[model samples]
Target: MPCRDLPPPPPPAHLRGWLDEAVVRADRARFLSDLGRRSLGVGRLLLLWAVAAVFVLGWSFIGMAWMAFEQHDPFGYVYGLILAVLGAGVLIPAGFWVARGARRDRQVRHLLHAWGESDRDPVADARVRAPGRSLTWLVTSLVLGAFGLWVAFAAAVSARPGDTTYGEVAYTMGIGQILWITGLLGLAKAAAHYRWAVRTFRAPAP
Candidate 1:
């Protein structure tokens, strides 16, 4: 037997607005996370490119300097070019400049997922500020890398001056030095990045 007339069932409430809001939020979070990841990747690549560039430049400088010592040739146009311009002007400044930037922009994003929101990151309060970790690596690594380049360049330059092939030799040596210096510097940066990454993104203890 059916009980007759309770009132008709309440009309169903609409949920489209709530659903849309949730979807939008999730999409924004994903986008931010992606950007954060991309920024990290780009920074890393730049650091490496800068390093390689330095090494190549250093190698060239070394070759030129070595030619200075060689007696096979006199101070030719080659000597003036390297000593005057590319070595002093380009590679040296480039090395220091890149290193400076690397040191400056190091940071750990506490929650990349909240990139879209004003203040919705789940762990917004848990951000751990990392200081000096990157700078330490940058300074130490850049110095070593730069020094290595200088040594390589100096070696080539100290070769007997006036070697007939001094021009060619010097050019080769300088280019090699620059490339090597850059590589070494880049390696140091990579190592530092790895270290920082390890620290910043350390897995939570169980």
Candidate 2:
């Protein structure tokens, strides 16, 4: 007589438990990795902005330096006139650029916090390490940007070649300074948010 085939056996008890735990960890890991990407994304954007700010500041500096070598007061009068036009046009726009980056960084910080505040808290197991590198860049930007602004102010008010020259150099300097500050502020805000995320996640659960 043909015997009926035995039913397939259930998985071993210990193996089943271990498998479930592994699955949980794996799922959490994937989720945390995504979150980390988001956290770092803001930093990357700030970095791009920082580059642009530096470029503008550098180019303006080059223009200011040219005036020093020419030493032709009339040429300076023309330079001052050109700078006044650019100061109002370009410098004003740079302020908005900074505000834009800061706004984006602010929104990102909120998103980072919301991730852990979810009702289920399934991804709490993910750990965040100290963001020393990000912090360094941020602080550097702040200090440098501030110094740049001061330099611009000094240049603008400095003795000019003619009556109309006014503070042409100073105006140009101010624009460069503002550009740097905006980048710095954006980076600093992002670093602060990242630090908070890491600390909050690592803290003992309520």
Candidate 3:
């Protein structure tokens, strides 16, 4: 008689159920892991933006102070100096905070990547957490951008060529430009995060 071939048997019932459960758990873990990674990425971007804002604003104020002093405008010089001091105050603390956060983020990212590659469950891991909706960030960005635009427009409208030097106009415009650009970028990031969250974390139907 010719040799007969038989199909392999399916998994045992209990084993099949357990296997399906494992798959579900693993899928959830991977989702959480990816979410955590994205959150960290946003955080890093915000931190970088903070550094840039501090650097640009601080220098802008200092440059304005110098220009105003050269022009012998007492009010402008004093105003500029006050702003410069305020900028320095913010920059000092922000610098340290950003550096620490950057280091921590790098460490967390490494851990999450390793956990994912190893098929470890990120849900069980406390380090993995979901990000917020980012509404606050979005609103703040819009407000700052609006305020900057208003300031820039007002400065441009009020200053006459005879009364204002090129340096004065340039410095005044620079502050507003920096603020609006930073705010616009922040708004984009916040909106992106919000959209991602909405898409990824849809509510389950009752």
C-alpha lDDT values of all predictions = 0.49, 0.53, 0.59
lDDT of 1 by residue, 9-96 (tens): 1112364345565654555445444434333444554556565666566545655655564534556545745664656665677668
How well is each residue in 30-94 modelled by candidate 3, as lDDT tens digits?
A: 55555464543455456646665785666576656667666677787787678768767766776
**Which prediction has more favorable lDDT, 2 or 3?**
3
lDDT for each residue of candidate 2 in 68-119, tens digit (9 for 90 to 100): 4356687776775665466456656666765775565455455445444321
The candidate with the higher lDDT, 1 or 2, is 2
Alpha carbon lDDT of residue 45, candidate 3?
Answer: 51
lDDT assessment of candidate 2: 0.53
